[model samples]
Target: MARLLVTPATGALPVTAGGMTLSLTDPGCITSLAPWRGAGMALSKALRAAHGVDFPDPGRISTSGTTRCLWAGRDQAFLVGPAPDSAALADHAALTDQSDAWAVMRLDGPGARDVLARLTPLDLRAQVFEPGHTARTLLGQMNAVLSRDAANGYEIMVFRSMTATALHELTEAMKSVTAQGGADPSPG
Candidate 1:
């Protein structure tokens, strides 16, 4: 039998143009952690002890080192960037491996928000969606988890099957922003 090789959801190389760069990112192990009903506080404590990150509240992203707990929905968060100690977290939340179910991409540059503004309806203005904030929103027509990881950087997660579409939309937006001389209207 021929061996099957694993490939990244998108290509491994970054696509860059006019100072904006979009690159596929490996966020280590991605675990979906849903706290048992009424176990939210306990889960947050246990997570902080085990991973040094709090189970985030809605629209937040908690971080400690490279590990992050991103609020994924009303009662769920994604434990990303390290292999979670399942034994430590199993008691408080339902832990499911989501390592291969999604594609992770990083968009960074001065024109990043401008590019994103062209694609998403959500306000990317720094005052409204500052660094460390996250949202479950539409990226073009696809559902995506968008996080502002830095002043001019974002991490976008989408279903693995939508990788190409996401890339195409983002690339087109980036091109348009670049063509417009990188004008950004969102206040810092």
Candidate 2:
């Protein structure tokens, strides 16, 4: 089996060559509503009144269908899409360009959550970590935004500077899990 190697700052982690692949990229097309500073109650209310759906609670929102919104922090939320319709959500809160400020790493493998559990405090058990669910938590002591991208994969977001460290930690965890030959506890 191909090993999960840690990449240097400018290097991209291999994403398609092994049991698990990690790809690092600059999501230039994405934008974050992170700067819209306000209380959660106000934002949720505005979103519900405007969009006809309740704004999801923090660590909740699934990324399945078109246009999913997630609470990235107490005062910030992130909208993920081929193109974020900031204007639609802007009517209720503030929007800012976070495309250039963050690095997105896509992690895919049967042991993906095993790698994540070592870094994040959130429970990665199948019963709890399901598709469309998201959580803003710390990964390897650094703030990270995570979402399950598929039944056996995840997408982890962190600041640009912390990317290398996050990858290193994840790689180590995956190795440990593979050595033990344990099945991933996450549900499909």
Q: What is the TM-score of each candidate against the true structure?
A: 0.92, 0.72
- The whole-model C-alpha lDDT of candidate 1 against the native structure comes to 0.88
For 38-73, candidate 1 gives per-residue lDDT tens digits of 999999999999999999989999999999999999
Task: In angstroms, give how far residue 148 of model 1 lies from its true place.
Answer: 0.5
Query: lDDT for every model?
Result: 0.88, 0.66
What pairs collide in candidate 2?
62-132, 63-132, 126-186, 126-187
Q: Write the per-residue lDDT of candidate 2 for residues 1-188, one digit (tens) a residue.
A: 12222245637466343377777744434445543445456656655554443456677763434555666776566665545455556655677666555668888877777777778999877678787678888898999889885787787888777777777777777777777774465454
Q: Candidate 2: how many backbone clashes? A: 4
